[model samples]
Target: MLEQGRIGTRQLSILIFMMVVGDMMLIYPSVITSYAKQDAWICALVGVPLGMALMLMFLKLSSLYPEENLIQILRSILGFWPGNVVSVFYLFFFAIGASTHTREVGDFLTSQIFQYTPVRVIILMFVITIGWGLYHGLETIGRSSELLMPILIVFILVLAFCLLPQVDPSNVKPASDVGVVPILQGILISIIYPVGELIPIMMIIPYTLKQAHRTRDVLVAAGLGNLLLAILVTISLLVLGAFLTQHNIYASFVLSQKINIGGFFERIEAIMASSWLISTYVKAMVYLYAFTVGCAELFKLKQYRILILPVSLLIFGLSNLVSPNLTFIVITVVPYWIDWDTTLSIILPGLLLLVHMFKKRWKTKSSG
Candidate 1:
């Protein structure tokens, strides 16, 4: 109803793709190696189907109310009072995620590239950039993704291909060393990260040009992303081996380091890092945009862009305060904490869908 005119379905799909593919550059390897051991790649491969299905479910739920974003739909289905409560909770989840994701990216940059810079400064720069994008709204963000995705993909693939010679294939031995249980555990965890996390995409379904195909588009984009991640994870394992891949904080980075093209090309991790950085940047923009737009819709604000600065500042502060040190981040925050964090996103919307469906059935029966 409110004409934000920020983005359309094609751009929306690009944002989703960026969000899904972006973070894999950093966290995917670590999550996979945690349980799967030498079979970490296998865990990624196994988890993809489940992740795709979960994403599809999210797409379907959102499609039921094509004209309403999740926030609007929730309010409509549940009534203003209860729906507002749900909206508040969902907003909290999304806001915290935005801050945490911001902090994670900042921490990575400070550690890997800008060793002397303060985390706050690095984070502020990110917040400012993302804030600008969010202010422009989702359509601009989506178009930006479309422009950036190809270059990002090319760099990622080139780096992976360069490292192909290093892949021993033998490194992935004793297929069941960690056993299926651990692998499944890893897959379970992996499913929630970027895959199941697409639940937030529902907030933008109202902007989709092809409303009838919204579910299919989200599923296809999500599936493509998971397939790419699976391939990247598998290649990283094959080239770097399980032990090295696990030890390396950024396994993909390490894999990039292993590349030596014709003895002429070397130390190309910088290129890989740059490409991954773009992906993360795009991902952050999408989340920030959604948060702003959702708030605008909730309060019926004249312009969502007004909140971008204040929200960015809030996110900047929270990102800094989320953890004591990067170790606290890698070992505890991401590995253990995020599991509980993602559960709300998956379960809450699902419950809402069921509730809405039941309400429709009951009303139909009563009228009959």
Candidate 2:
């Protein structure tokens, strides 16, 4: 009940789409190709349906409590004490998500774009605007997403086609050269990061306009986003070759660097960076939204916005503490990111839904 505004189905669609593409586009292809190699796009192509299936796990759970955000739903189903405990873990997930993403933007800027600036200053600067967005509430955030989604899509489409001339077909050739097992393994990463991470959307569900078809809207939107991601991965592999795509920390950005039309139009990677920042901003707001709202609900506060600054500060502190540098994130956090996402997003929500179902059956039997 902390949210007074309701976002329309279209807004819901846009939010979910960005949520799918958000950070995954920057990082997923590299990790997948390291496993699937030349067949990474295959993993992306095949993971769509499977990813949507995983998305349904949270969507269905959200549908059951159209009025309650994920926090209240947790307490409603899992009892007072246990629910609070599990809820804290979800808060950690959201907090880490927001923090890590803030750090990612900072990392990319300091290392790739700004070379001279300190990472902490960049993070501090960005989090300030994020705090402003959080204060304006969900409707504002939703509208921002609605406005940005088209620009982001246009940027992506331009990036894709401009690089097509540079792409070598042989790079992604020998399809399934890694065989089915590794491709299947790559599908797991594909599903978990881009799709399973839809978990945090649970926080925003209550504010979305209630509709029987809302789930379908989410799935379709997310499915579109997933397909776009697959295309990008394929494009990356084709242009950068499997080795660079596999080795580059941010392959999509490097892939963007390849764009040139008769050498007249080039170095548009800044535009790519802009589009990424837009999508990342949307996704980071969701994480910050989840973090703040979860705290407000947990402590039983009247307004969630009041907690935004403190929590943003907390996230900023944790962002630095989360890892020493991008190298540490690449080595340790990237591997474990899927694990943490799996627990809160997929495994725990699935279990909660089952328990809710079992309790309903028990009540029916008892009443009879």
Candidate 3:
């Protein structure tokens, strides 16, 4: 194996949790609320179990080829040349995912905090950090996630408590008044995001130390992560009201800005920013790792670490050119991004699973 480092199910769960909650806190409320209105939280709540069910299929796929990543699975199920062709599609998918994630970090830092700094500079710094993480390997990233997980949990608790005073129960009133169709629309998005995008982790899932409880731990972690997201969406609606939450680009960030206890603890929106940074950092790092691993496997390289620098450089350029600005992301990319997620994460995985089962049965009959 190119990656020799091994992590337990615990670290893997933390990584998944981080991936699930990452950028959604910043942007999801606005979009979901626009569809389901106040019942956006309802959609999120409904999404938790559905997302877990989806995750189960992914886990089952990984177990089907316990020693192989998705690229190898594709090759095994499909033939050598055909599998490589399909794998190329994943290579492009991972590359685009890495670029978009890097751009998100850069965009948030420059637009919200460092108005004077060039986005290129911020992106450069972020890319360098990711490269450093990649050079060290997956174990380093997993251990770091274990450390960050507690801090992330603290941030979540503080956020919930600090914003409680501002919550208005009436805001979420008239539940589902927008009708079942809109709520269903909101649910579809809730699944597409965070959950649907989990396909990249198939690359790293093989690195995890197997245990009887591996699947349970990871699913529980996802459930915990999505439940917190639902709570935050509810809080955003309650504090900002459905209309404002729907229109505001960063409703959770704005929610944090409202935190005040006798004026001493005011202006701690930075906490929310810090939380976002930790989560996005993990998610972006995983996508980059997947891309690098795919490149190494495609070419039959000895190790993936050597390709990190050039791949990082390519992604740096792509990040700047991915879209013109945040408006493009909000207005144009957000809609299509879900479709992209559906294709790569859902459609592809399901296809592979079907072919794998049919081939297994055929081989059994042949041997008989």
In terms of lDDT, the best-performing candidate is: 3
Question: How many steric clashes between backbone atoms does each model show?
Answer: 2, 0, 0
What TM-score, over all chains together, does every model reach? Answer: 0.94, 0.97, 0.97
Please say which candidate is ahead in lDDT: 1 or 2: 2
Global lDDT of model 2:
0.87
Give the winner by lDDT: 2 or 3: 3
- Mind giving the per-residue lDDT tens digits that candidate 3 earns over 1-368? 98999988999999999999988878888988888998999999999998898889899999998999988988988989999999999889888888988898888888999989999999999999988988989999999999987887898789889888877899999986899899888998888786888888899998889777999999998888888888889889888999999888888888888899897988888878988888888888998999999999999999998899899999999999998788888889888888888888888889988998999899999999
Candidate 1: Cα lDDT at 140 = 73
**Residue 160 in candidate 1 has what lDDT?**
71
What's the C-alpha lDDT at position 303 in model 3?
94
Q: Candidate 3, clashing residue pairs?
A: none
The weakest ten consecutive residues by lDDT in model 2 span: 206-215
Model 3 / residue 132 / CA error / Å:
0.6
lDDT tens digits, residues 148-252, model 1? Answer: 889877877887787777778898897878876887777876677767666567777777676456556767777777777888778877887778777777888
The sequence of per-residue lDDT tens digits that candidate 2 reaches over residues 1-368 is 88887888889889999989997778877888888999999899999998889888878898788788888999999988899999999888889899989999999889999999999999998898888998998999999999899988998899888887787899988887787789877898888888887777888888887666887888899889999999989998998889999899799999888777887888988988888898888899889998899999999998887898789899889878887898898889887887887787778888998999999999999999
Identify the runs in model 1 with alpha carbons over 4 angstroms from their true place: 211-214
List the candidate 2 regions with Cα displacement exceeding 4 Å: none
